[model samples]
Target: MWASSARIYAVALKEIKQLSRDRVTFAMIVMIPLVQLILFGYAINTDARHIPAGVVDYTQNQTSRALILAIEATQAVNFQHHYYSPQEATDAIIRGDIKAVLILPHDLERRIALRSNRLTQDSARLLNEPIGQWLVDGSDTLIAATVRSLRTMPLNDVTQSALPQTPVTFEVVQWFNPEQRSVVNIVPGLLAIILTMTMILFTSAAIVREREQGNMEFLINTPIRPFELMLGKITPYVFAGLIQVSIILLVGHLLFSVPIRGGLLSLFGAALLFIFASLTLGLVISTIAKTQLQAMQLTVFILLPSILLSGFMFPYQAMPEPAQWIAEGLPATHFIRMVRAIVLREADFLVLQQDALWLVAFTLLGILLASVRFKKKLS
Candidate 1:
């Protein structure tokens, strides 16, 4: 019996040693889940605030400005632009300059003073009224709710004994995501972050490790285009990422009970764009880095800002002006909005057209740049 036990112990020890020899296996056993848990916990916050907003005021009267001031008063939305036409405002949203557009119709001032004259009653009807057709990026319910809440403050009680004549009475109408549940806005963006950071990191180290082992030279000599090679490498990882998303969304749906308000096909399509964009960004990093360590360091640097500027942590509005500009530049910033619009608001393409376009542009630009830079590096 003693001899048998000793032999069994030796076999177990050898198996353990073999498992420990593979760094990936060891890390998977002891580190991956812990790190991911920390990430998921830290990243899954719901308090959305300070959304960037563009204003198009055909009613340039004091009442219009007052209404802008009213929306601004909540400190939830920053009025970043005052365009002459709604088209310009839409352009800003497409440029990723703002998360939503506030459009004041031609007689906005007159309509505010007396409820009878609304210029775009049809537009208002399309948005379900009172919100007056606010054109949001349609991504985040948190900001939508925040804006909605800010829009409908009680009218100044002129008869109140406290104060007889207040200088400004601002009336606001928030167009989308009226209830503003955190789950609605946060989940979609959360989906994007999970796909972006995890898929990129997983593939980043895979290629970098091959290079460290002297195998990537063979791959470099192949006739495959840089973009094609990168795409092939990321394809498997994207599939893995989709599985991860399925797990997360399942958890979100079953445990957290988050609803899927948007069309499933549209939501999945957006997710694919975000995944492609994130993977291309990782490929760009892999081209710049020589080792897995360097790739990891670079990924962390990118990940931090992606979380912060994407309006997942600080409200884009609450950040200082320069910070706001930087936040708008991040891809995650747009993804977060896309997720919110689809999951929380049940928004159609018209409401989200600008955001969808910008995301496509960003994805195409990233792939093109990565391919160019990667080819140059290899040559």
Candidate 2:
């Protein structure tokens, strides 16, 4: 018993010393928990307020203005853009520019007055009518639920009483997800996450694998350009990423009943750009990390933030400005927005041009950086 205990203690001590020596792994051990705590505690907020929304006030009258002000006072919706038409507002929603839009009809005043009277006594016409309409992007289940719950918005100027049940302030029309199934949102988000995990993990270990197999020195002896080498390493993974995408989408559509409303060309185009970006990012990590273990640690670090800040788990509109800015930098954020736009809204690629361009730029920049960094390693 004493001998066995001594051997166990010695092995434990050796592992502790080794862990301490591996500064990257040791640092990751400390950083991962700290990052999770900070993100969950300070960043993630479920009771989301100051939601970005648009308005299409067709009436543009005193009553409409009052109603808008009242909604703003609730702090649930912040009217940022004023659309001339509901179509414009809907396009904005599909493009993910805003979560919801208030469309006040030309007869909004009459509707509000009728609703005010109906609060005292029930009438069939007033019961069926809505003062205004809320065109909501139901891609995010949480935000949609919050917007749906706003049945009792207090109209102070026209009517002092809150509208409850039958004649609500605004009748919500959920786009992209009329059913509001969580699966519609999850499948596309899972696409982004799965691609991110696989592409980055596979390429992150590329150079380390070369070193581990004693081929790195031989490659260095040759006159292979760094950029060429990077292309060679990531090109295969790009095809692999596409295959993974196809599998996930097929399974999601068939098993989960997630709809593929957009053109396959646009979908695959976005995937291609994102795949290159992720793989190049992995290559950059491969150049930085000294070992396969460190490469994996770096991938984990990127993966965590990508999942949390990528609008996959939380509503992007709900996040603070700083968090939003950080999220903008993550490739996953742009990809998730693009994928959701295409799949859920059947949006044209032109609608999501900015995010598409960002992904392209990300791939180009990541490749350049990886090539340069790898060249330095070669030298």
Candidate 3:
């Protein structure tokens, strides 16, 4: 019995050793997840506010000033920079500097005065009130509506005057992805999707690949423990994941100019936790799958739900209570939020502890399930 046990232990040891030498697997494990984190964090943003606006006020009259004051007071929009000339404001909009531009014609005050004068002359005044034109960036519909509804009432007394010489005022505000660069937000989200998709998919496939080749039968017949087998399979991935991370970060910073606001230590810590959890999930899936096709199919099923329900593409808070609860349970949901906070907000550990704990729990649970199933599969 003692000799047989020793042989079993030796087999497990060899498997662990063999895993250390797989360079392709190692690179996949390390480099892929890191790239995803950088890409996803840059791409996803829900809390879009403070749009850039441009103003071109030809009126400059007291009536137009009142309208401008109303816009400034509403707090819905902010004038980032103003152009004295209408041509400059239009050019800025075309160049993507400003999302929306406000144009006040020279006759705006005169029109308002004319309408007011007409209203006073007859109780039922049939005067044409010239509608002011507000040019908005068609890209952000929400911001456009906000800019259009700055004020409803006219600023000056229309009954007393026919209208002023300078009647119109221009105010423009930029909306969603206001920096006007699509890559800034999309790149970060790509990092997350790539990391989760590639890492989980390949890791799940590795075990099935070995089994199909009959290598798993020889290793299992030798008496290697389930935990050891699982660890051996995952160890190579951990190293690969780290390498992929470095390359992605380098590319995002150098090529894309995506900023990394948080401390390297904190970001890496969060990444390790997420990777461990994700890899374990793959292991669990592999244990349940009888063939490589089955494993890939299962991964696809899990991937779609995780991506959709995880608040990656949409806001979890906006969903109904049932959907919200489902989102809360997904590891991707928390990871997405964690990566974004780290990159954008530079959140401290205290702020991110909840997500960290969740990832740890997920990894532990997955490891336990995979180990039990792995033992059965081998037996």
**Candidate 2: tens digits of C-alpha lDDT, residues 1-379:** 9999999999999999999988889899999999989888877777778888999988987787877887788788899999999888888888888999988899877666665565455444675666778889888899988888775565444456554433355688998899989999999998889999889989989877887777877887888898899999999998899999999999999998999999999999998889988998999899878789899899999999899988899988778888889899999999999998999889888888999999899989998998877752333
Please give, for residues 79-174, the per-residue lDDT of candidate 1 as tens digits.
Answer: 877788877876666445677777767765343334322236553333323424477654455555555555443334212224332232233433
Ranking by lDDT: 2, 1, 3
Full-model lDDT for every candidate: 0.65, 0.85, 0.64
lDDT of candidate 1 at residue 206, scale 0 to 100: 72
TM-score of 2: 0.92
Q: Rank the candidates by TM-score, best first.
A: 2, 1, 3
Per-residue error (Å), model 2, residue 111: 2.4
Deviating ranges (above 4 Å) for candidate 3:
1-180, 376-379
Provide the lDDT at 295 for model 2. Answer: 90
How displaced is residue 308 in candidate 2, in Å?
A: 1.3
Where model 2 places Cα greater than 4 Å from the true spot, the runs are: 1-14, 117-128, 157-168, 375-379
RMSD of 3: 15.4
